[model samples]
Target: MNKIETVKIPRHVAIIMDGNGRWAQSRGLPRAMGHRKGVEAVREAVRVAGDTGVGFLTLFAFSSENWTRPETEVNDLMGLLKAFIRRDLAELHGENVRIRIIGARDNLRGDILPLLIEAEETTKANTGLTLVIAFNYGARDEIARAARKLAEQVAAGVLRPDQIDAVALDAQLDTQGIPDPDLVIRTSGEERLSNFLLWQAAYAELLFVPEYWPDFTRDVFYRALAVYAGRERRYGGIAAAAVTG
Candidate 1:
């Protein structure tokens, strides 16, 4: 696959990493194996995004609904998340990758908080790519939280109801500093967003692939960009016709 140059690349790309369990089952291995392998895909995505000079890459690492999984799997996932943080923080910092974790940090383990703090702090000064890890995120939950905040402020007489708009609400969302996703790619042939980034991906170009997260590669990324390039993004606006020669 031909790689798209930076000039044509989307500014922000989000991904729904799916099919880990099915991938593991197909290989006669524990489901954790799929999750483990998926981490490599993440590494590749990060490196490629950095190389391509993409502004933002948000990976749906975990969602609020993922807690319904078996307790053992959940624990394993948590452990793997921690291990990834421990193993990758220094490298991310050195590579100028600013790692910012979104979603509910309250659910994260006590031990993990310090590592999260260190990771964000260490990479805070870096300027390459803003890699967002949606750990315990749900788009609905994010919007609800923002709404509640707006209501509280209104009740306190600090703001008026009409003052609320997209920019105002965006400030309250977890992805305050980051741009809304321009493209969202889901692996494992999943056609749904599964509540990944409901509010942020309002108009994002979505691409679904049959390949599972464990097997998603830079080539797949290239293919996705190619598809995106062929798309006509009207964004609810009418386009002007080209002048005849």
Candidate 2:
């Protein structure tokens, strides 16, 4: 196992939590059981992130396409979400963790929207780790929404078309003020982004782990961090060693 180098800790870490249903099915248990266990992993991840001094932790809790799942399963997921916020919001806020929700808020269920809002409001004054929850979020949709905002400004004659560059669009994004992720880890060995944070992850170091979401532990997280520390991020430029050589 690689030792995590504290000096190289990533400022932002985003995770695509996957394979909950498979984790339960492999053990001959119901899929819902897997999701419940995944919640435990979420708690561990948050604690570990805080301890590791990761300034931002973005969790892909739910995507917009998840609504296509069976109604019963969707209900189960919703119930778990409500239960998690109700049970853990105070504890998270007390820990000085600032909660931020990023995603489309239009047409969310009445009960769920209020809980998300309350969580953010309650933790707005926190100064510790920023816990970002991507709920009902899709990168493509996010980009489109941002574009529409810019278009609206142009149509209103408040902004010119030429002024709509990346910076202007970025300010309209849900993650406007947040830094881009330095590391993106996906459990269950999945390598794809699945429409999560496509724009913000332009230069993130990607890691795909074999462990399922329910089985993801603190050790695994640390190992991922160690791997990230070993990497040399050059963005679009060449490495210094190569240039010097």
Q: lDDT per residue, candidate 1, 127-200, as tens digits?
A: 88999999889989988999999999999999999999998999999999889898999999979998888988
Candidate 2: Cα lDDT at 67: 96
Off by over 4 Å in 1: 1-6, 240-245
Q: List the residue pairs that clash in candidate 1.
A: none
Candidate 2 lDDT over residue span 206-244, tens digit each = 999999999899899999998998999999999989999
Identify the runs in model 2 with alpha carbons over 4 angstroms from their true place.
1-3
